[model samples]
Target: MNKAITEGLLLMPPAFSNGLDQWSSQDGTVGSDTYDGAVNAAFVAADQDFGGCLELLKSETTQKLRAMVQTPLHPGCYLQIKARVKAISGNLPNVEIAGWAGGAGDVHVLDVVEAGPSVALTSYGEVVEVSAIVGTGARNGVDMPWGQDALYGHFGLNLTGANGGVVRIDDIQITDVTNVFLRDMMDWVDVRDYGAIGDGVTDNAAAFNAADAAANGRQVLVPEGVYALASNVTFESPVRFQGQVTAPKEVRLSLTKNFDFGSYVDAFGGDEVLALEKAIQALFNFTDHESLDLQGRRIELTRPIDVQDVVNNISTYAIRRVIRNGQFNVLADPAWDTDVVTSTASYSASTSTELTNVANIANIQPGSLVEGNGVGREVYVKSVNVGAQTLTLSQPLFGAASNQSYTFSRFKYALDFSGFSGLDKFVLDDIEFQCNGISSGILLAPEGLIFHVRDCFITKPKDRGITSHGRGCQGMLVDRCQFISNEQPMRAQDRTTIAMNVNANDTKMRDNRVMLFAAFGVWAGTGHLFSGNHWFHGDGETDGVRRAGVIFTTPNPKSTVVGNYIDNNFIEMTNEHDATPDWNNQYSFGGITITGNIFTVNDVAPWFSWIVVKPYGSGHYLHGFNLSGNVFRALNGNIERIERVDETYAGLDMSKSRNVVVQGNAFNSVDTPIFNPLMVRHTEAANATTWEIPTDGKLPFGGRARRVEGFVMDQQVLRGSNTAHYEFPYVSLQQGADQSEAHLKWSQACRGRVQITLRMDNAT
Candidate 1:
């Protein structure tokens, strides 16, 4: 797919002979270069042989071969230049590539190590396709910084760098390479004379207004230059602020005010970059598009501050690399008031004295009226209120029939996004957001709109870093974003992290790197597709930082979590209830299509208790669940741990959960595949008695204690083992599994009550 659109000057001369004697002298020049009928003379040194030099001074000779082509190559067209080098002497010499356009500062070079030895006279030709420089200062994907004159072109085999080897170069040719195959994929427009609004001269405000005039229809180009700013600017165009240098180097975009990083100190002392501060606010709010793209521009914050927190200001991670001045610091504000209210239910003393509690229930909403039909089946406000931190669901009550258990099954919701119509697209490519607090990073109201965040880096967001509950927010895609945590700076309190916390349908999160934070890396809602994401834990919390690869509560119809890597998360972390629900539910939140994912851990096994397949409610049908093609590599054993307190563990729990298939996985070092045990906890309420039965009486007796005198009771038998029963199938290996073991394990878990299926393949 090589398309040649334009023709530029081509100047590469040809050479004859075999060794150094023919190329050492400047007087000996060859005239055989061609480019679209244009040709140039290739000069050579004399007294050098065509093929004999051995043990020659290579470094000194190469330093003299630096030659500059007088004419510049056109950037609008793709060009391929070929130079022929022959092994006229000893061995082959190394090659270096570099390009420069107009300005002295705008120059780029790519060093590639080619694999080739000496070539005899019979084998004397090889063509290499060098990759062109991208972004700014590049024309048609190639580096053409020499401008129209192209006088600064320099090319030659640096024989000086070679230790003692020598080679003769002949017949050098340069031409416009054609890419006719990909005419559709590439579009080339003549932008050589395009006008720029603000060449660092006009008002910054006016520049932004003109740039974003078309919203998502235009891509404003930022040429190489220094753009001084009196005020901040914003860009809403589909523009790319390509830079010639890294941040704070050649170009600078100075700010006027100070940015607050909460506890995280600022790089500049007390002083803040006012322009950047406004930009930070805009990025988080996703509103006010004033001054975001600072291409190749250095930004000087008014003051220097320290940055310790990494979870609150996820943008700080990108800003960190931009710091080039005095005492670069970080500043962040804390989120002391961010939480959610869950659902709860109660029962009458006589109707249902034995009541159980379930954390993080889904099928219920807030402030709703419910109906009932009989004595033991009534629907009240099925929720417990917890302060300002509350989450309101769409529905609360379930079936209120007397003949059967009431269960609220599937609850579907779509997040809304209002107030954001002027904005069309939100593209965050190659950007970084690092949080610096103990709270969430991004908290959207019930109506946040369309978003496309790609190639962005986010780190350590205090609570749930990014969560969405808004409306009109369709086509939400997060791809190639890096999510990590930093515990060194802000040690006061750890903000449990969830890279992407969204409750939306038709959502897609793909190819993201989620490192260890506080808790679950990705806690999603329903109707979402999570594919090819990498999740890992660096720290060894009895449970590693990530609690779940993808956590969702409600029943989702078409949600799929495929081709993800979830390993080493929630490792070594104890499952003892620090709170009611331990943090070991790394993959607790479920109701998803878990397929083709790799789960590896050393200790804290994957949670398969009430959390794994917990039901929606009493009579609701929870189906369409599939757990296939997932690989689990364990260093220690125990891949699954399930502890159920009640025999009737709801319609949502795995007992009643259907259509869950676990096959085509890999497991190592893990002793058992699954473990489930019944646990009984003491009542936390007041004194109550319903049924009293004599344990020692031989016959029917009431309120009478009978003692067995001849029986011997062992202390070990009375006090059961602390661990649960280890049963069920183990994870499958990728290479292939034994048919017998696979069948045996498969039958044990899903014989009849549930249909368990198995296939031996190397798909993981």
Candidate 2:
């Protein structure tokens, strides 16, 4: 392109009126006739239609003229090169308008001998127009006879015949007609302008970026083909996608025009699951958006969506990320089925963490729950050794002995975050998980900080609601959520799935509701605040069966269970982590505060207590246990007591447990006339010689009476004890400290109703 003429800013070669400046003939040393590859070349006058013309006298037929246009041809543009030519004298020769492709610095790349149809000059002094359409590429009706590179295109003329005559050529023209075939001229740039191939084999990274940079502020068009981008691509301008692109998962993409999932839905033609997967993958890898908004679309998945994978570039992300406003429904796919392994395993009391098995250990998942006869609750297989045929457990078994059949159940979650180890400040807000009775709600990361789940509904999960496999629940806040399990209509005793599982510490559960599960929440963590919750799993049956509403891994947990509506459920405290407290410090074991909670039973069992201490070993006792400000009511039968050690274990050692406060609780027709500090009243028989009464198994927490203080005065003493006006009764404590019974001997068996205070001793 020599000079511009404004036809799409078409650049033109110089006219012969300028005396052939920038035009040259091929030197004659090789294939041409003379030193200038011509016998003679002179600028001269021509017909009036042409201002002037160049006359070249070809001594030999191989002589030719060449003119190099330094400007590069636009990609996908076809240029028509034409010239008027006629033979002056001698035999007529055919002249062809040929062009050579150049790369850089006018360097010759490849030449095409026949750019267009060759025209033979038949008559002397007769004007004939010869034309050819040469294109930068072979697309858009331009065949391979004319193909131009990105840098330069040199237009030339060739004459053939042994006795070629003098020829005068004039009115040379080069016109850009790219838009005539590819598209109309517009304010946008096509990626093909920068040598982008749509064949799906060539990497389009460099070409795409060049087009984007050339667009400046204009829109970029990715025209139809499959383009492979081997590296990450960033676009600061708007882009229109008419083709698909493929890249590795580690390659991040920034489409500034449209970054929402709706746009992807449009891109993939309404395939929502694939759109969601792509959107989430973009969310984690790129810096464009910190949160992924599902826009209230219900995406159904046939398999679990693993959050952490090799596709993501970042492993430890402390930035706050949010995924909100979407409902995930599970479909019936066998991929949702969790792995389960059943095998015969033998456990030894001496080796609590190792289980010897003779089965397919390769099928056992490392994090599967280990359940068998004598298997402790909340025990999981930490690791599996296929060579040794042994399973390492997260916690030791309780009383595992001999060869027992064990079941290792691996849990599959709808949204699995168990792959990330250092993910923090991630929030899951306003999401509904419809598990469809096949999968669990969410599986948390193994190690993270402050994973918040709020305003969520986990409904009808087959296994668990929100489970923490490791220290992922550290500082986790679950607020304004509901966890209802698939055991909704099952009896409390028959239900097996738990609503929630907390494996880490410092979890704050606030304003949550739970319904119909074997256990409302079984947690091992400390510093938990369970407030404003209503947990019930009764199923309204008359069997009087109940489930544990609040269960702790350690009996002396430092937590507060307050303002909860507990119906037909009991609280169980245990030490499933270790059989004894020797492995832990005293500070790790703490007291419990169960106050301001409502405990009620509809058709209660005759042996149900509001709270029970279940320790695996005898060394741990209740410390700072407070059962106050709670109301226990029964509809059909009376509850035995407010609190008791598990009936399967021995009686509570009152001398070892201390700081017991069980008061301010109102019992309705149950635990009638309950008084704190272990008290009983009796009216002596008329004219009795001696009196002895047994107060065994009637006191709460298995209190053993230390001493009997007062004999209540009757009839006129203003119902006072230890302010008696009549003779005082002599009382003595019996069955001391080991059994919960008191023996009293009144003074000479007086015929008066006496009330004595049986002061129970407490351990320091």
Give the top-scoring candidate (lDDT).
2
lDDT tens readout by residue for model 2, 318-357: 8788889989999999988889888888777677678886
Candidates' lDDT values, in order?
0.34, 0.69
Return the top candidate by TM-score.
2
Q: For candidate 1, lDDT tens digit of each residue in 565-660? A: 775542111111111221222333224566787766654534422123333233332234455666666554454432222223243222222333
Model 1 TM-score on a 0 to 1 scale = 0.37
Cα lDDT, model 2, residue 724:
32
Question: What's the CA RMSD for each of the models?
Answer: 26.2, 5.7
